[model samples]
Target chain A: MSAPPNRPVFAGLTSAYPRSEELVRATRDLDRGRAGAGAVETLYAASEKEVAALEERLFTTITGGYLRWNDLFRPIAESWTGFSVGPLTRWLETNTFFRQPVLAQPPVRVPGTVAARLPPVLGQRPEKARVLLPGPYTLARVLDNRTGESDGAVVARLGALYAEELAELRALGFGTFQFTDPYLVREPPDGVLETATLDAYRTIDAARGSSTTIVWTYGADPTPALRTLDRLPASVIGIDLTEVEAASLPAGPEGVGLGLGIIDPRTTLPENPVETVKVVREAVRRRRPSSVWLGPAASLDLLPTKPAEQKLLRLADILQALRREGVA
Target chain B: MTDALFPTQEIGSLAKPSLEELRAWQEKVPFVDRLGPSGPDLLRGDAPEALPDLRAAFAIAFLESAGLDRVYDGEARRIEMYEHPIRQMAGFQFLGHVRSWDSKYYRKATVVEPVRLVRPYHLDEFDFVRDHARRGVKLPITGPYTLADWSFNEYYLARQPGWRGRPQRWAAQREFVVDLARQALRPTLKALVDRGCRTIQIDEPAAGTHPDEAALVVEGFNEATAGIDAEFSMHICYSRYEALLPALLEAKACRQWAWEFANRDSGDHDPYAVLRTLREYGDTRSIGLGVVDVHRDPVERPEQVADRIRRAASYLGDPTRIWTNPDCGLRTRRLDVAYDKLRAVVAGSRLARAEFASSRR
Candidate 1:
């Protein structure tokens, strides 16, 4: 499960890559009633395959690309009982938006819903493939909880559902599960951080059997929550390097992996490999943890297709350079 | 303009014509055929040259029928708000499409060098709209703050490699926005004013994206329209209006704050509570109140629109300072839906005016 000496593993964050021009056109046509759902699904499948191929070459861990997802919460919102997709809310500060999940009642996991939403395994080794989900804390923060339950209760319920989803995915042969918690860093709710948040992570960690769990936090600095996040029972803790300095990062608990977000996905400006290497080296030198996962600071969906791919290529180059120098 | 209690205007941009709609318009207005043949290929966007005049004529006709007091040609000649201005400006290159919401995307660009206007970008569109329109025209221009926030800034970032993180980002953004105001937007506004443009609406929907940079938005607005001789208003929608306010109060050159409320507040109860934030911040400028929700297909009842205006008026304490409009542009709606929405606004405005006159008696 460990990366080889002096080499850091690379992976995509929670979301899909930006849709290609052909896919964009197909989706648009479907919106305009010029094309059918089947036509758009065909394009989605094609796009997922293209992304899987690219990730297979550039990343140590592969992703399903989540091409069918309109937003992070859509599949769960649509499939799960007692949850409905609401109006478009801006996703953090980015131009992109997600349909907020509105809770009518306590959520119930409908069997095969998460499985059906997942992409068909596109020829990658099963152990190297990862599925991304919104962490319970983030899901609780973003959702309109009309269930009339306390925030803690909502987190606990969502945590149980995510755990079940992770267990099912693990049985289906995925080896890595990344729980994205952008809201946990951006705006953590009162009191839940001390109790429900940590318990939710524990619930998910207990369910993930022999599979690696990554808690990726982005869109804000995680310095204040680093110690609390380090105590979670996850394998790796990802922080957005674009939002914080390398020197500011503290070392995590022994044996916990470090997900070093070296590339910024929001900007179109290409990263200089040398400058990225310096950041990785400085971060590694300071927060010398058990392992390293080098990747973009946030979802690549914010970028255009070409720039998103170029960023991965640049990350690959940075990883190679790091390996050559025995930096990690 | 009509001497009404609440004037009605659209927040620019009607729906672009479908091929069938274009053909129908050509048949109705025979002069449209003078521009080019009404063919299917024209609707595919290949014949931008032949379509602008026809499109403007159709839009003006539509607005005239809607009976709004203040009207523009629905920005028919231009592309979507962002790309239309950025395409004409120097030092920017179209990168690719970025999603704004579900199934909706815009072609975003990168700032490769210092940004400047290539020419008067909106002159031809303005001239066509002015000559053809029967009502008073209100032009909507993309503001510099939005242009800087939306684009990828390489030129500004490249200037200060030594500085790092948020400080560097803020500094570069300030320089880029101010430069855009000085070099591009100021000239465009001045030219529009010189060419007899009366009311210019500077659209800056990205103003509240960064709450910390609210002052930056105000600075950009003030810088762009500094010496321009015209009535300048600002239209910001689907944003954190509360965050932009206190800071937006600093925009001295801006005469009105045109903002969207109907989209967020469903007009059920105390729908204009957000308007209280403007009053709290001492923003006493004229308010372009958004009473129609443009995102939905079902037409809001004239009573609902009037109710919204009445509630907003209670907060402003002056119906004369309020102008009624949709939450944002109707470009997102179908053509029929957009027409119905505008007609509803006009009807609602009349109803409110009648109520105000009765109350005075």
Candidate 2:
């Protein structure tokens, strides 16, 4: 069977050299002990400006690399330790400087807020590409919930919000969306979580025309969720070629597209072209996936700056080789 | 903080309870309850009525003679860590299902409504120990980052800028955590401080997982200990400490940082070069060096515990600042084994302390 049409391999990039401009400015102001509202505003303004510039720079790729929009929103959350979702919501609604989308859902809804942020950020890039997300399974693994909500309830709501956001993204000219689920590798996901997640994806997939490839990334064995994968209406399912242990290859669908995450984003280990070929061969032998594409398992945020760029170049090399082998 | 840290001791974890003694203790101890699948009953906190009997147990057992300085109420009353107080608090939903964060092999923590400590669960545990132990008692509670790391992420998942829904809920939840820290942790710690809980060792196995979020974890701890004047401590073990070391040293909230030194993987030695690297952070805090390995089959002797403590002490550059301890908490151990190990800890401390004092002279 012929492989499904694959999206271009997008690699992460670094710009403005060793120093992040926002960090430098924040550090400088912080060093001067400027702890006033002006300092805070200046720092945030610089971050907003840098983020916009980053989106432009990523698309431009001065280094001749494909762009991966990784952790742009996450860093905003990370920098402010005091930033809880509650204050963030209040901040977005109260501030006039924060522009609400003209052709967007109301900001009161979680998905709408995600929708409002997407067009500006995703729209900035002219490239037809897939977007990355920490999926419901993974997102549930990383938060503190003192709000008396069950983890299931929390993840279900998030999945619903994500489905809405994914639907909104499809409307905003994004064709291929990759949902990054790292936590799935932690044994088989619970049956209930798996069901909710599959349902969420089906909702998003049906809305987005069944063409978007939702890729699960990071170190995980997908054998347990293979049934869920078969039923979910996505066009392609990305597998981490490196971490999808050969023993874990489950007997599943032949038509499902696969995003083979072969590159190591977190380490400086040079990608051996020979070893990679062997992995790709194994993936073909077992899953016989519609398409087996190679990329990083997770975001470059987990890596130090130097290793990230090196890994990106390795990805570029692998992409060229995979095309030559007629694997795409 | 005092110059002295964790004194070397026998690992007081699983004491082999003969069938007869087990039955006798069960009948005698009012709260002889078993928790989880593993059968070590939580003993001291809520169960034992008074300090005198606990002291008598220590005296009869010669726990002090064994060289153990810090004592626990055998986790006597606690059903599980973090859940006991959360169950007591208002606005908590006990989901009734116990789920492991990763897999069952690593460790298991219950999922609950985001926890804020309104009252200290370990209070009764500490009070019983304080009333009885001739030496200082170590207070154990689940650390803040562990609380944050182990909870559900619905409140923290990726947010869209205009989407304010999850963020609003997250704010409320975080408020509960911070408020819990303020109301429950602060007062409990202060009460322990007042009750002469000289060495307050907060147990935070969760901190190691999200070491990248060290600053936030440290901030939470600092907030918890804002106006307290006790030798604050933190114990984490059996996992990667590399991510947490930098943030912990940077935070400097705890006057002492204790961790497991020996394990099957670590080969009965200092796991990482933590003692040597700890000096890089400078010498403000004491090190509760785990000389006794709790996970190992054959119980370690006082001399073996002493040797490890000596090595850690040398690495720490201050013998006085080194405290000896088990690699982890003894919640997994049987009562007989637990008492035996604790006795070894006390003995080991005497050996190491004598060695250090003689060397100084």
Runs in model 2 deviating more than 4 A are A1-328, B1-65, B99-120, B153-179, B191-196, B264-272, B357-361
What is the iRMSD in Å for candidate 2? Answer: 21.6
Where is model 2 chain B poorest over a 10-residue stretch in terms of lDDT?
A: B99-108
Question: How far does residue A102 in candidate 1 sit from its true spot (Å)?
Answer: 2.4
Report the C-alpha lDDT of model 1 over B325-348, residue by residue, as the tens digit.
Answer: 988889888877888898899898
Classified by CAPRI criteria, candidate 2 counts as incorrect
- List each candidate's DockQ score: 0.40, 0.02
- Residues B1-361 of candidate 2: C-alpha lDDT, one tens digit per residue: 2245445432222233333454455554422322222223333343433333333343323444444655555444554565655554544443222212100111112223344445545665566666555565666676655554444323222222222222333453355446556766777778777766666677666565434456656766877788888767777664456656677775455877777765522332245466677787665576777766564445778888777777776677777777677777664555556557766777777777777777779
- iRMSD values, candidates in order: 2.3, 21.6
lDDT for A243 in candidate 1 is 74
**Reference-based lDDT, residue B115, model 2:** 42
Provide the clashing-pair count of each candidate structure.
0, 49
Candidate 1 local Cα displacement, residue A300, angstroms = 1.8
